[model samples]
Target chain A: MCELDREIRRWRRQEMRRSSLSPRELDELEDHLRARVELELELDARLTPARAFAIARDGLGETSVLSREFARAGAVRWRRALGYGWALFALSFLLPALRFEFTHEPVQVLSLTGYEVFWAAVTEGGFRHALCNLAMLLTLPALWRGRVRGGRWLAGGIGLMGLYLLATGLSLPRGGGGFSASLQVGYLVWAASFVCAAVGLWLRAREWVPTTAERPEA
Target chain B: MKKPVYKELVAASSRPMVLSILAGGESYGYEILKQVKVLSGGELEWSDGMLYPVLHRLERDGLIAGRWELTDEGRRRKYYRLTARGKRQLARDRVSWRAVHGALEMSWGGGHV
Candidate 1:
């Protein structure tokens, strides 16, 4: 019974890897798997490896190989997308902070310092930085189009944001001084834009798109 | 007369042949292919790559089950066999096929006369 269960698992893995099984094929496979489990419960001696293999080889038709290939391709696509998303998120948050630090501008209040400074930066510098980040986040939607389009938009957005962040940090007032009224307004716009872009991108990610190859016609 | 079409052979033998082969004993991938070829007198040919997916579907359907075992030869092989449900299914399939065959023969005006 244990051996039979192991074989069933092996077959299931193989099926997952093959990926080309039609809905009917998948249904049939599930049925067969269940039958095996039932037979195990019954402790049937007829459920030998030799016999099971014969049934599988003969009963399963020609499309099995295609299904396996499709499944493998899908797994690869999912892993790639997940990796991309994580990297993008990390860079989105970390790059701005890094740029502000390296530039060493006096007006840049949001240094790696006390909570007061951090909050000050968010309240004062947050708007401009957020705007730049919002623009960066917008590129995420274009990513849904295709790899090339998404990559282009993401790269362009990130590059522009980086430049803007560097400039803003360098131009900030020093000695705990607040930003000018015009700078504050600009910062608010940037912050609002960033929030909107982030929300939009987050919503877009929820939409289902085929990460794997196109499904075969029935 | 033209040789039996590959499609016709496949369509005709799909279930009965599969069940019959399993009736002998549990067998794995390559062994099943070898047996089928011998049983069909070398006429029925299935590609090696195509068999695994079908096997998976059959396993999925509860008609059959599979397991991996290490042979005395020290190689692990995946084997499959019919469940009780599969046996019952085979019996039903045989009846239906017999009816279809009977109709075809009757329409032809009797057995290979």
Candidate 2:
């Protein structure tokens, strides 16, 4: 009986693993399986052949290929992705706005100085730096949407690049005394991109394919 | 004893029998098979391997729960038990079964008489 029980546990674990059940879900399933085994033992003690056959008939009704808990997990993953995307978008908008608000006067002064001087200052900031930041901002939505053919790799790469850009931006000299119009425009663009990314991610992650028809009950 | 009817009997008896067993207490794979054999007087036997699928389904439906535990002898065991919902469902099932049985008897017997 113990050997059989071990085998059953092994089998159930394999099934749960295949279903990608998380730690909590696997724990719950293990508990349920254990309870089932105990009940079977008790019934084995009491039942006669015909009655057992009848009981087995009832027990086996409507078998499913996947556990309900695991089935719901896919939806949960999509929701998490959507949430993360929205959070990043919110942060993207908030951080830049905060920076602008704190140094509004300097930003207005910088804005009045015309594009040539502004461009020169930013150029001193380096093309690679600006390009990197721009790329990071642009890639935010792509990462958030995360459904392109190479989405996972792309998102990972973009995330790394974004981190690098952020680190570089922080390390760069804060030469311009305050927020410039160019900086404001850059901030707005980044915020807009983040919002778009959030929306895109939400759309992509949403289980919009009408799962009702696919539901077992349906 | 014919193949098709034998198959039908096997199919129909699987779930209710398992549910009934769990209604008593928790059970595992081999023991469930053994109990079924005993209950049916060996007339309605099931392949030992096929029981897991049914068990999995029942667990999925939230009618039963399963867990693993170790015995004093250092042996691990998986057990299953009925939830409150399952018990209520069993009662409803009993009522429905009785109704169906009664209706069948009334219709079939009235004609014979």
Candidate 3:
């Protein structure tokens, strides 16, 4: 690598240390900086390495400013992901297992003993619903984890989720014994959210893409 | 030579401009900035890295999405493209831009009855 490239890389390392962004995000930021530098070089053949680096850095703006923006974006999304994920988790057990034990409701809860509750949870539709919530809950972390380091896995996960949603949406209760319309709509909403999140995550996932020769540090 | 664009206008319009441009097709950061300069006849000068924040925010809001891919020149570039949400956003931006232009024309045009 050239002297300027080394300097740029060192500067990136420093910024990455100070920033809370993930490694993938840091790599992306570096990619952006390099792009600016290359563009500068393309437009001007006579510029010195130091001069070009300065111009590129200046154009990309101060590291702190860019870092702050990325940090904020990451924080906000993580918070949303955590919140949504936890809510699903809490609702799963609270609405089914805990509600059965605490509220004395015989409708949803069949067994008073531990084994009975376990069996009921597995067999009962309400507990099954809660399990679905648990599955949704897992998507949040896996989605982001996949975004950072597992692009192909995330793509496959989302693809499977899409298939599941399609199957569920298609096989709606065609006038069941005790099936409610609102519950059906809830399934649609949950499935739609999953599909939306899956699509968004799939688009952002780049780990599976082959590293180009230009990505020296990658 | 055209005069430099005001910083605030450039900052404010970056989101809509990016969304609108991507609506045309996918492009990387450097290419997008170059297109903006050409489209403005070299009038608008966006602060070098300012668009990154805007792009990040849009992605967070689900307005646009990006991917890192190889170019024909063997350079790895982060390409941005409009998402379905971004398309809807551009439609809104188009209406708002037209309204602003209409207002400006009405204000600057010859006195009307």
iRMSD of all candidate structures = 14.3, 14.2, 4.7
lDDT of 3 by residue, A134-200 (tens): 5555556544433333544654564566568547543333334542222233334444455555544
Off by over 4 Å in 2: A1-218, B1-13, B111-113
Per-chain TM-score of chain A in candidate 2 equals: 0.34
Residue pairs of candidate 3 with colliding backbone atoms: A59-B48
Q: Please report, as a residue range, the 10-residue window in candidate 2 chain A with the lowest summed lDDT.
A: A209-218
DockQ of each: 0.03, 0.04, 0.24
Writing each residue's lDDT as its tens digit, candidate 2 over A21-116 gives: 333334433433444555665769665433443343344332233333234322344435545544554454444321222265343332222134
Sorted on lDDT, best first, the list reads 3, 2, 1
Model 2, B1-113: lDDT tens digits are 52333857677667777888888888876678778889877777676446665776677677788666554543445577888877877787778777887998999989965
lDDT of 1 by residue, A1-218 (tens): 46655766676566544443433334334444444344444565566754564455445544444554433422233224433543444443332322132234464443332223335557886565445444554564344321223433444455455445435643554433333312332332333333333333333333222122222224
Give the interface-residue alpha carbon RMSD of model 1.
14.3
Best by lDDT: 3
Q: In candidate 3, residue B11 scores what lDDT?
A: 79
Residue B60, model 2, lDDT: 67
Task: List candidate 3 segments past 4 Å from native.
Answer: A80-218, B1-3, B72-75
The candidate with the higher lDDT, 2 or 3, is 3
Order of models, best TM-score first: 3, 2, 1
lDDT of each: 0.50, 0.51, 0.61
